[model samples]
Target: MIPPAVLRRLNSLTGRSAPITLHGTVTPRMTVLASVSLATFLVAGMAATQFRSQPLPPSNRLARDEALRKSVNQLEDQNRALKTRVQTLQADVKAGEDESARRSGAAQEVKAQLDEQKTFAGLTALHGPGLTVLLHDGTDPNSSVDKSLGWTIHYQDLQDIVNVLWASGAEAIAVNGQRIVPSTAFHYAGVNILVNNASRLSGPYTVIALGDPPALAGGVGNPDQLAELKSRNRIYGLGFSWLRSTRLSVPVYDATFLVKYAQPLG
Candidate 1:
């Protein structure tokens, strides 16, 4: 049995107040064994507590993954929509370009037509191969051959020659540097013969026509075309000559339009 004083002292040191009873004889060895046994139990219990598994808190991983999936889907949808919009814009741009090209082509065609009209209206200068007809007064001053006007170049002679040139498909004609248009007038003005009513043509009038050189020359020199002129040239020594040229140029008509009441005939 342990002494009461010793047991109380042991209780005071260990801070224990419960009653301690031993069945064996109280000995130092027994006390030591009891202390070691209590220590081992406390150590084992602490170790068990330290290594014990605990339930984990609820996980948000599944929710986070779902949110990420939704975000990626939204981004994909936006990308697809952008692609569609881009394709539509590209088609529209292509259509616009095509329309612009078509308008440009039409504008070019219209410009070409206007230029052709201007050329045909004698508003533009012309240059090509053709013939030059020269007419002058006759040298013979005989009273019988002259008949007061037979020896001199007249407006009728000019009119006849111009008609022949026209029949020969002359593209352009000029008299003494004056362009002959559809409105040109060939008539007598006092003692001098007037051409285009703007120029008084003197002797040796030069008439230039733009056409096939050989054709124009042949048309002017044809006896059938100028039968009366040929007879007069033989009878009264009237001067008439025609020559072919590789290059010829006709000036643009400089006179103003004077047809006030007259509309286009054809």
Candidate 2:
């Protein structure tokens, strides 16, 4: 159907009784457009009413900013107080540590002195000009025919020799390159001599001692140890030889010991 505006123009031009349906001259496209416009207006009115439902006071930017600033300042004051407390605690701890450090330093110095004395007492390894004593088995390749006569030096020989050397001016001693303290031991494991329960030693057994050569030589001049030594040499034909050297190295004691009954004496 034609629109009313177009029908009116036609009536003015040709003078017909409006060539449109009695219902009106609304076209299908025009009717759709009018329905969409009416729906849009109703939706817009509903949205405006919903927005105006909750009317608000005017914006107060300055008041909100002032409140935020107050909150920030309060938080900063709390943070500052906590930081000050932490600093004070740190200072107190530092003062206590400084006082304790003085005593700790003194204790460390004492320990260093004690360790040096122990090292000098042959509790640690040392190297210097000293002497070496070689104790060999009496293995005469040309004349040994008796099987009962064991031509080897026993542990007793080794102990006696060490005692004699220590009684002399020998400062330090080692058997088979093993350091000897008062706790050192020598025993027979089958046919081999075990030193310090760690190393198996065989002849010729080497005994190294560190001391002043002149003092050691003069002090070890007793012939009683010599007679016992000679008797063994005559009976078993054991070999004994000693030499003073300008250089010798004594090793550290590597054996472990457990002391269940002893405590440190003040």
Candidate 3:
């Protein structure tokens, strides 16, 4: 319906007014979004690498646990050894105490036996009816003197009296308070009579003999030794007396003598 030139110009206007379409290439906004996405991905990867390189706390914790376990094992072993040692020491102490008690009991038994033996042997003092004989030195003025006689009171006179008293079954005897035992000795030392290793026996030498007075009196009556003792007493101014009493006490004698051959055997 229009002219050719007009139609051409109307078509041109219509084409200009219509929207254009791109079919072969991407847009600038799409490229920019892709680049941004790639950069974000690289940053995330770098952060993961740093985290992997750092040390973990659990590794140190495991090592500390292992060390603690070793220390506990050492402590347990030490405790076991100490327990064993304590047991050994306890046993030793008990054994020592037992041995001590045994020794103490043995010592007490021995002491009791010794005491009993001493009692049975009559090793203690005794007091009963007895006889006493008195003798004096011839040189003393307190003695009786007969100028016509000759002999002096010698050591033999005292020895004879002691022998007669023993023969009369005297239980205990003492001369001048010197107790007569089986080991008692009489000897002369420098013109003096020594009894039991002692001297200076002078006037009023009282000999205590513990026994039945009647038996002792019968043993000494009218004996030859008595006649000789009387003769000496009259001749050389010696003194003599004999008496009987109801009670006279004799003391115990304790003596310790060394033995050369004594030794301890294993």
Candidate 4:
């Protein structure tokens, strides 16, 4: 309880620099109540701010978790499918290799059979140690054809020489690069003789026989063979040369012969 004149003097000294100007004296109880109310409001505001920044609700959280789980499951399924496809491709590769191996083996077997057939059929050329028979005309080109007294080699004389060589165990025979086979035959059209009906070997014929060289040459030394050759030598004036060699090549048979009287054995 201050006097009015004293209070006016105190206000005059303060000079209007205060937040609130009190006309009455301050009370302890009122001040305490005001502080408590202000503290409670600040605390409530802080709680509201914290609540606004909190995590999402249970429904939204569950939805996010379900979506992530489904994505993971889809990735796992895709990985499994890729693994299955890889395994299938590996199996296919292995199968292809096996089939190629089978085909390769079959091709080799067929080639072997074909080689054997060619050898047996005399379609393939042969080379071995044997004898060579060379026959030449006795009449030179300077001599007249009629006056030379038919001094030329005949196909019959060549046939006799081949028969003698065959009896001497000649494995293969060729006359003037002409391969002789079981179906071979000679044709005489005047002075020119066609061997095997496929080729016409001129004068100075080369008869190659593949076998034991000594045996084949000695075969021409037989009495009947020598007589057959000598008897023709007087009339035709033909020259014969029997030679033994370490290597002789017999040409391949080119003419095709179909046997109507024979069948293949199983």
Q: Evaluated with TM-score, which candidate comes out highest?
A: 1
Tens-digit lDDT string for candidate 4 (5-29): 5445444544655433445655777
lDDT of model 3, residue 165: 84
lDDT of 2 at 20: 40
Query: For residues 1-266, could you state the per-residue lDDT of candidate 3 as single tens digits?
Result: 22344434444544666433335566787656745664575567669878999997768889999999999999999999999999999999999999999999999999899876653344677789989887776663443654532344566777888788888878888777767776566776665677766445653578888999988776666555578787766766677778889999776654433348878898
Q: How many backbone clashes does candidate 2 have?
A: 0
Candidate 2, which segments miss by more than 4 Å at Cα? 1-112, 120-123, 140-150, 219-221, 234-236, 264-266
Q: Give the poorly placed runs of model 4, Cα more than 4 Å off.
A: 1-42, 45-81, 119-131, 137-157, 160-172, 209-238, 242-266
TM-score of each: 0.68, 0.53, 0.46, 0.52
- Order of quality (TM-score): 1, 2, 4, 3
Clashing pairs in 3: none
Tell me the alpha-carbon RMSD of every candidate. Answer: 8.9, 15.0, 16.1, 10.7
lDDT of each: 0.83, 0.76, 0.71, 0.78
Candidates 1 and 3 compared by lDDT, better number: 1
TM-score of 1: 0.68
Model 1 regions lying over 4 Å from their true place: 1-83, 263-266
What is the number of residue pairs that collide in model 3? 0
Local error of candidate 1 at 248, Å? 0.9
Q: Local error of candidate 2 at 87, Å? A: 28
